[model samples]
Target: MNIPKQRIKISLAMVMPALVSLSILMTMSIMFYIQYKNEKRSLYNNTMSLNLSSAQKMAVTIEALFSGMRQSLRASANNPAIEASAASDQKELQVIFDLMLQSSPYFNSVFWADQAGTIRVVSPVGNNLNQDRLKTEGTTEALQERKSYISAPYRTPAGRWIVLASEPIFDSSGKYHGMIGGTIYLEENNILHRIFGSGAGNGKESYSYIVDSGGRLLYHLDKSRVGENVSSNVVVKRLMGGESGMQRVMNTHGDDYLAGYASVTMNGWGIVMQTSVSSILADVDRNLEEQLRSMLFPIVLMLVIAAYTAARIAAPFTRLYKLTKSVAAGQTVSSEEFRPHWNREADQLNHIMRAAAESLAKQTLSLQQEAVTDPLTGLSNRRELERCLDSWEALRDPYAVLMLDIDHFKSVNDTYGHQTGDQVLKLVAAVMSDDVPKGAVCSRFGGEEFVILLRKHSMDEAYRLAERIRNAILISKTPYLLPLTVSIGVSLYPEHGRSREDVFQAADMALYRAKNEGRNRTIAGVKSA
Candidate 1:
C-alpha cells in the first residue's frame, strides 16, 4: 500500500472528470429519489383530503335530518294545548300532532305520551295508540335525561326499521311531563335513502352507510342488514366510540378498505364512506410509473451539468444549509434571495418555509384571541378582565366598575331552556358594549354576571352610565320571551378602594342593595375618598 502513492498521483485534469462524474451521478440519484417520494406523498395527501371532505358532508346532512325531526317535536312540546295534558284538550292535541306529521314527510308517525308512558294522543289514529312505552329504552331514556333524544334504529312489529326522536315536555314549574316524539322510518324514507345513496353516486364499488353510537346499523344499501349489530367490526367500534378519521381496515369478509368516517352531531351516529383499497391505489400506481419515466431524461441531464460544475456545487449547498438553519432557528428568509438558477430545490423549500411560518403566526394569533374571549357572549372573559384590571391598577388610572346581573336568570333557564338563556346574556352584553365609551371594557365575569369599566369617569358620570345600561336592558325584548330587566351597582376607583378586590366588594354590596330595592334599578356605592 505504501508503494502505490507514486502510481496513484495521475494528472489532475484527467482524474478530476472521472471523480466528479461519479459524484454527480450519486447526488442526482439521491435528489431524484427525494423528488419521487414527495410526489407520492402529495398524491396520498390529496386523496385523503377528498375522502375526509366527503365524509364530513355526509355526516352534516345526516345530522341536519335528525335535528329537524327533534326540533319539530321540541316546538310542539312547548305548545300550551299539548303541555296541558288535559283530557279536554286531547282532541286538539291530536289535531296538532296530525298537522305536524302532514307537514314533514320524513316522519312516519307523531304522538304525545302521558307521564305514565301511555300514548294518549297519536296522529292518524293508529292501533299503537294507548300502548305502554315505558318499557322501551327510548321513551324511558327521554324521561330520565329530561332532554331531547334520538334512539338507535329498531325494527317494529310491522317490519319497519325506525329511529325515534323525542323531546321531554316540562310543566310551567319545570317538572317533567311525558314526551312528544316521532318515528323516522328508515326502510322507505326518501331522505335517508338520498343521503346514503348520493354520497356514492352511481358507483358499485364505493358506498356510504350510517350506524348509531351503539354500533347498530341505522342505514345501509343492503336492505336486509338494517338494524343488524355491527359492534364486532373494527371500524364500527372506533366510530361508535366517537373516533372520527380515515382508516385502512379489514372488512368482515377479510378484504381491505379505505374508509373515512365522522360522527353525526345530533345523535352520535357514525357516517362512513368506503372504497376498495385496490381502487384507491390504482391511479396512484399509474401516476407514479409515469412520473418515473418522465424524470429519466431530466435526471441524466442533471448528472452531466453536475459533472461540469462539481466544484461550484458545494458552495450553493453550503448557502442553502445556512438558509435552512436560519429558518429552523425562527428567522424569516426571503424567497427572492434564493433564485432557481442556483438551485430549484432551494427555491421550493423557501416557499414552503415561508408558508409554514405564516400559517403558524395566524394560528398563534387565533389561539391568543380565543384565550381571552368568552365563547358565548363575545365579551372579555374573567381572565382578560383580571389582566386589564391589573394593568390599570399598575398605571394608577381612575376607572369605575359597574356590576350587573340579569334579574330572575335561573327562571329563564328553567322555563325557556339554556339556549335561550345564552341568548339573553349575549343581548345584554351587546347592549352594554355598544352604549359604553370607546375606551371602556365590558366583560362577562361569570354566569349571569357582567362587569363594565368606565375609564376617566367621575362618580356621577358612572352612576348615569349605569342607569342608562339598566334602562336599555329593561326595554330590550327577546325574540321568544318577554322583555328582560337588569340591576346594576356602581363603584368608583380610588373613592371606594385603591385595589381591585375592594372595589369589587363595594360593587357587590351595592348590587345587593339594588336587588333588594324593588329590583331593576341602579345603586351607587358610598363615596369613601
Candidate 2:
C-alpha cells in the first residue's frame, strides 16, 4: 500500500503549531486548578475560625447572664425582710419571693428549707404554698457545706426540669439556721431562647443547652431535650467533669455538629452550645461555588478565544489549499480567477490579482464598445440609443430633449462620400460635448442625432446651452474641407411631454418643421395644446 506524500507533508506541518498551543493550554489549566484548590482550602479555614469565635461569644453571653442571676439572688438572701420572713410566717416569706419575681424575669421560684430537712416552697406565683415537703437531699447536703451551691438539674413533682440555687442562712451567733433557695425552670426562661434563637442555623439544626455534672441535658432551646442523657459523646464526658472542651460530633439524631462546652464557675453545671456544620459553613460553601465558577469562566473564555484564533489563522491557508487542489484536479481556470490568500504574503498576491482583473476588464470593455457604435458616423447604434433614452427617462429630474439632423446630410454623404458625413457627425458631437455645463451628460442617440440631460437646470438654461452649441456648429469648418450646418430642434420638459416618448415626438416634430421651414436653422417646439 502506497501512502500519499501530500497527506504526510500536511500532517507534519500542522503538528508543531498544535503541540505548542496544547502545551500552553495544559500548563494554564494546571495552574488554574492549583489556584482553585488553594482558594477553597483558605476559605474552609476562615469559616472554621469564624464559627469558633461565634461559639465563644455565645458562651460568654450565657456566663454573664448566670453570673448576674447569682449576684441578684445573693443580695436578696441577705435582705432583712427575706431573712425575717424565712424565720417567721410563711405568708410573709411568700410576699418577699413574689416581690423578687416581680422585680426580674429571671427568678422562677423562691423557697426556704429548715435544718430538719423540711421544705416550704413559694412557687413562682405570689400566694402558692406547698408546705413541709421533703427537702431535696442534694440541697440539704449543699447547704450543710456552709457555702452557696448550684445543684444539678432534677425533675420536680410537676415533671419540669429545674436548676436549684441554694445559700445557707446564718444567725448572729454564727449558727446555720436553714437555707434560702431559688428554683429556676431553665426551659421557661428567656436566656436559652435569646442565645439559640439568634444563633446561626436553621430552626431544627442548631441549639444551645445547659448540661449537668451527670452529663444530662438540663435545659435546651428545643425543650424536648430536658433530662436527656448525653454522656456518650466524648466532649460531653469531658464537660461533665467541669472541664471546658469543644469537638465535632454526631449527636444521637445522627446530625454532624460543632459543640462548644464551658463550665460555670464554682457551679457543677456546664453549658454546651452546638451548631450544625452545614449551618456554620454555609457561607463558605456558597462562596467556594462562586469562586469555582469565576475560575472556570476565564478558562472557558480562554478556550473559546484560542479556538477562534486557531480557526482564523488556518482559514486563509485552507482556502488556498482548496484552490490548489482544484487546479491539480484539472478544473477549468478562467481569467477571473479565485481570490488570493490573505496572510503575510497577501500584499504581493493582491497587487498581482488587481493587475490581472484590470487587464481583463479593459479587454471586455473594448469589445462591448465596438459592438454598440456605428462605424460610419462613430455614433451610438440605434439599439444603444434606445437603451440610453430609456435609462434617462427613468431618472426623477426635469430635462430637455433635442434632435439634430445635418441639413442636406444625405446629399453630402451621396456627393462627398461617407467620409465627410462621418466628419460632420464627429464635429457635431465635439461641439455639443464642449458647450454643455459641467454636470450635464451628453450621449449619441443615433447617427445624426444626440441627446443631453441637464441635471437640476432650468428649461431656459438648457435652451441657452443648446443655442450656443448650434451657433458653435454653424460657424465651425469641418476637416473634410467642406462647410456644413446642422438643423436643431428643442423641446422643454412637461411642456412638451410628461414621458420620454412624448418628448422625442415633440423634438422630431420640431426637426421636421426646421427642414420644412428651411435648412441650416434652429427651431423650438410649441407646447402641446
Q: Estimate each model's TM-score.
A: 0.44, 0.49
Candidate 1 lDDT by residue in tens digits, 3-75: 6455565443333335434444554566567766776556555655566678888888777777677777878
Taking every candidate in turn, the Cα RMSD to the unseen true structure, in Å, is: 16.9, 35.0
lDDT of 2 at 221: 61
Residue 95 alpha-carbon offset, candidate 1, angstroms:
2.8
In candidate 1 the C-alpha lDDT for residue 401 amounts to 94
lDDT of 2 by residue, 247-314 (tens): 67787778887766677655556766666766645755576567668777776665565455445565
The clash numbers for all candidates, in the given order, read 0, 0
Instruction: Give, for candidate 2, the lowest lDDT window spanning 10 residues.
Output: 11-20
